[model samples]
Target: MEQAELPSPPSPARLPWDFHPALTEERLRLCGRMLANARRDALAMARYEMGDDPWSVGCRAFAFGRNRLQRAASSGDYPWLEVLDDSAHFVFVIGGNGNGVPVRFYRGAADEPTERTLRRQEMEVQQLSLALGETEAEGLAFRLAVET
Candidate 1:
C-alpha cells in the first residue's frame, strides 16, 4: 500500500492594526514571560468584565488575538510593534517572517464610542509591545521588518 501525503500548513492570518520597529530579541523574551505569567489573570479579568452575556464573546476574541501575537513573538519568525492611541485602542503592526509583508490588529464595535474602548485596546497593545520589545515611543516603526 502507498503512504498518504501529509496536509499542508495553513497560511498565517493577517492582523488589522499597524506595527512599528520596536521588536528586539531581548524584548521578545521579556514580553513572552509577561504574557505567559499574566494570561490566566487576564482571562479572569475579562470574564469579570463581560460576565456570561453575549458581551463575553469579546473576551474570547481578545484571547484569540493575544494568543496569536504571543505565539508569533515567541517563535521569532515575525517582528511586530504595538501602539496606543489617545483613546487607548491598540494598533498592531505585524510583519512577515523573512518576507516584508505587514498586517494590523484591533477591535471594533459599531455601537460604542471610540473613547470607551481605548483602555482595553491600549492595555492589549501595551502587553503585546512588551512581549515583542517594540514601543510607540521608540519611533522605530515599520510596516514590515524583513529579516535579511
Candidate 2:
C-alpha cells in the first residue's frame, strides 16, 4: 500500500504583518476606484495589517483573507489599509467608511525622508494600525518597506 502525504500549510501575506481587514474584492474595487478618482496612482505600495480596536463593525469585519498570513488565526480581525506615494514623501491611508476605505494624505516633512526615519515612521504606523483596526495601504510606494 502507498502512503498518502498531507497537504502543506498556506503562505502568509507578503506584507510586514498580518492584518484582518482582508483586501477583499469589494474593498479592493472601492479602493481602486478612490485612487483612480484621486489621481493618486503614482503609488508605490499598499499594506493590510491587523488592528486592535474597530470604530465601526460595518462591512469591515468581512475580509476575504486572501493571503496565508491573513487566513491564519488572528488575535483581532480589524483591517487597516495604507498607501505610500512615489517620492516616499507622502503616506495616504484608507481604513474606513462603509465598504470603501477613504484616502487621507500626509506629508512627512519639507526635507527628504531618511531611510531610518521612513522605517521609524512605518513602525509607528504599523503600531497605530494594529490598535485602530481599520486601515493602511501602499508602493514606488512601499519601497521603504520592500527595499530596506
Candidate 3:
C-alpha cells in the first residue's frame, strides 16, 4: 500500500518583535542562534550585515527571494535594511558555520497596504525596526491614510 504525503504545515511569518542589536558581534551571534532555531523549512534565509556592498547583498537577497512563494526580495544600498511583501512582516536568522561568518536574517515583508492589511500590520514595521535596534528617535513616523 502506498502512503500519502503530508501537506506542509502553515508557515506563518515569525517576526522578531523583541530584537535589539547589542554589540555588533553579539547581534550577529544572536541572529545565528535564532537562525539555528528557526523552522527547518523556512521560506527564505539570507545574510544581512550592515555596510555590505549592495550588489553582494542583493545577490543573496535575490537567491533568498527566488525561493519564496511570492518570489519577492531586494535591497537598496543598505543590505541590513528591510524586506517588502504583501501581507505580513517576519525575521529569521541564519549562520554559525564557525567560519566566523556574520549572521543574516529574513526580515518580513511590507508591500502596498489594503484596509484589512493595514488593520493587521500597520504598526508591525515600526515594531520590527525597533526590535532590530532602531531608536525611538530614529523610528519613522507613519501617518495614517486618513491623516495624509
Candidate 4:
C-alpha cells in the first residue's frame, strides 16, 4: 500500500531530548499507530553505551511531524511500520524484521557514540555535517540518527 508522506517536523537540535531506557509493548502499539496518521513527525533510534558504562541501551525519539503507512516497498526510511504508540516520555514505533516489527523510540541526551556497532553511523553524520554545513545539516530529516 502507498502510505501518505507525513508533514515536516521541527529541527531535532532545538528540542530538548533525553535517553529512553526502554519501550513497553503496550506503549509501542498505542503510539505506533499515532505516528502513521500524525501531521508532523520525525523519529530516531540508536543502540550504544553511555560513556564508559556496561549499560547498553536502545533509544527512540519523535520530533514534531507526521507519519503514515511507511513500508520497505513504499518508503526506504521506515519500512514495515506496524504501530506507533506515543506517550509523554517516549514514542514507540514498530518496524518489521523477519520475526516482527521491533519497537524502538528516540528520547534524551546521547553522546555521539563511539561504539563499533554503529561505527559507520557516526562517520555518516560527520559527512552530512561537512556536506551540508552545520545549519543546513540541522534541516535534513535524515540528519536524525536512524537505527534498525
Q: Which candidate is the best by lDDT?
A: 1
Please rank every candidate by TM-score, starting with the best: 1, 2, 4, 3
Comparing 2 with 4 on TM-score, the higher-scoring candidate is 2
Model 1 misplaced regions, further than 4 Å: 1-52, 81-106, 109-113, 119-148
Whole-model lDDT, model 2: 0.33
lDDT of 4 by residue, 1-148 (tens): 9999998986675321111112334434444444432312322222234342222222112333223333322455544334333332222233344222223333222345324322233333443355445575453322122332
* Candidate 4 residue runs with Cα over 4 Å from true position: 1-79, 97-101, 107-148
Poorest stretch of ten by lDDT in candidate 1: 139-148
Q: What is the alpha-carbon lDDT of model 3 when measured against the actual structure?
A: 0.34
Query: Which tens-of-lDDT digit does each residue in 21-133 have in candidate 2?
Result: 44345654554444333322222122235332332221122121112113221213434454322232333333533332222222234146555444535543453444344
lDDT of 1 by residue, 39-114 (tens): 4444555655445543564455545545655555556554443322222132343333332212233344323424
Q: Give the RMSD in angstroms, all C-alphas superposed, for model 3.
A: 20.7
TM-score for each prediction? 0.31, 0.27, 0.20, 0.21
10 residues in a row with least lDDT, candidate 3: 94-103
